[model samples]
Target: MVGRLDGKVAMITGAASGIGLGTVELFVAEGAKVVAADIQDEKGAMLEKRFPGKVVYAHCDVTKEADIEAAVKKAKTEFGGLDILFNNAGISDRMSTITEITAEGWSWIFDILVRGPALGMKHTAPLML
Candidate 1:
């Protein structure tokens, strides 16, 4: 039988590891081409190699607008279109209590978890539609 996501294209952030990586694997298994974006260069390369043509890895630091835009472009170039975007990139001071987290830590978390996804949506909207 044909897969549910057959012929779809997906761009996923935080895809070098964890849930994001899992998403890439599942999407590909379901017949979608996936663009995996993450700052973990070594891990990202490994992911690209693991799936060969089905997966492309983009070195994306979600807090940076340029990286996010480049990721969208990479997806379009690699697959010719985008049908889905999974803004899975996020960070937090999990080692410390909220009250004990430093200001810089708060800023980092907010940038990655909030601003990143918002900018992702803005830049990738055209391609997704």
Candidate 2:
């Protein structure tokens, strides 16, 4: 059967676990190639082994531009091009009060939730079009 995402290529951040990992599995099942990006080295490698030609693992920290850049490049190189950039990596401050939110904490959240997605777009947009 032809899958919904047949021939599409996706790069998924935070992909070693949680929703990101779920997306990676679904995308592959749907016939999309995926780059699983995360700091979890073992999980990432395992996914690559499990999915074989359908998935490649790229070590990525959303807070780091170099890592994000590397992921984009990996998608392009390994799969021929990028069709999706799934910006799913994020952080939160569940226990911190507003006053307890230090500048570093704020930056960490913003870097992962906002700037990382933006960076993903910035780096991948050109190739996507």
Candidate 2 clash pair list: none
Error of 1 at 17 (Å): 1.1
Q: Write the per-residue lDDT of candidate 2 for residues 24-63, one digit (tens) a residue.
A: 9899999999999999999999999999999999999988
lDDT for model 2, please: 0.91
Off by over 4 Å in 2: 93-95
Clashing residue pairs, candidate 1? none
| Candidate 1 Cα errors over 4 Å, as ranges | 92-95
Backbone clash count for every predicted candidate, in the order shown: 0, 0
User: Please, what are the lDDT tens digits per residue for candidate 1 over residues 1-129?
Assistant: 799999999999999888998999899899999999999999999988999999999999999999999999998899998999999987643646868889888788889889999999999899866
